[model samples]
Target: MQTEASPLVDKFQLTEDHDSVFPKGVPWVRYHGKYNDLSINIVCPGKDSSLGVDSVGTVSVSLLTYASVQALHPDIIINAGTAGGFKAKGACIGDVFLVSNVAFHDRRIPIPVFDLYGVGSRQAFYTPNLAKELNLKVGKLSTGDSLDMSPVDEAAILANDASVKDMEGAAVAYVADLLKVPAIFLKAVTDIIDGDKPTAEEFLQNLAAVCLALDQTVTQVVDFIVGKSFSEL
Candidate 1:
């Protein structure tokens, strides 16, 4: 149970009223069991990326991130979800990664002045020591609005040194950066990029199992955060 005085409780006290900001069915949970002092909020923006009301994309994620910051003013923001791993990078289905950095793979600005921003890289908020402590793989993640990735796109992503691809990590990270809030991402591999089957098909096939794995992994992360000293956090 959470007390009214708890920072975590205070942060999310009004989240129930703004359910529209999050994924359609996923609800936000405020945990006070182990880390009552730390304010934490978890959200899952839906899978749709279009401009529709329930869409999921940079725009949607950016809005969610902004609203979350204004509402929570949290010490850290973490985006945990599923992603497609690249086989060429030794990634396999069911593997979980602690993203060290994130960038956009689909954003290709023709103009030279905007190219760097299109391909810009942002570091994860967690320290390398924390990743080692969690025993999770540290890798770069490429993000885009779409789940489907062609072979040519995979090649380009590999060239950029991204080991995993997700639909929302970079957008969340970018917003967190703009707000000067630390952010970290955790992704469980639900499919192999460029595999024999289509990425979407493979993801659907493995979604359930991957989601279970992600649940366990996220529990471990919460435990780690709760056990850490305030200075360490």
Candidate 2:
């Protein structure tokens, strides 16, 4: 998680790091600082305790979001990260997107209304001016825990009409919605899931360049958010 977030943290100069307030052995990391006059905090689900690797996926993100919201009381949340994209959806490696909607692709409940709940569709906060000014592509994002897609996941994602997919976006959206906080999702394309290259190979190859794009785009977004009201966004 820190690897993905490093560029943004560096670009924002978020030097004052705050350790997690959670119980001992929890690995959430928080960095607090200012983006001009705007107060900003960057939270990353730190390494898994036993595994010693980035604690990715929905559970870690959702838990950290809940804790961060309760502690920081942030007015807005930016869930920025890299994601797999679809060439069919006009995505190219290193392209950045502002998510318009988010949903789950792997939670197959199969019941009537529960099926809909399984999908967990949620629209992101409206930001027409921000999108226009940033000149970024806007798309629906589908989230699942798997790094690789299965046929069922593929069908679910297509049904949701998602252009991008990641491990954490929808989870963060769920928390933000529950807390009534506006959120912004900025995703950079790290791999093309529907393309010829293997998913992991492409993702690893493009990660560095994609992170650069993500860093630059997120910086622009924070700059845009400065001095703006929620209604203005």
Predicted structure with the largest TM-score when compared to the true one: 2
Q: What is the Cα-based lDDT of residue 91 in candidate 1? A: 85
Error of 1 at 127 (Å): 1.8
Model 1: per-residue Cα lDDT over 1-233, one tens digit each: 01111332333342433535334544322233223454456544433434323344577677777777886687777787789998878788988899988988888886986977987678988566667787888789998878787665666587669889987889988889999988878888999885787887898899877876776676667667875753474
Off by over 4 Å in 1: 1-36, 46-54, 227-233
- lDDT per residue as tens, model 2, 83-136: 999999999999999999999999999889999998999999999999999999
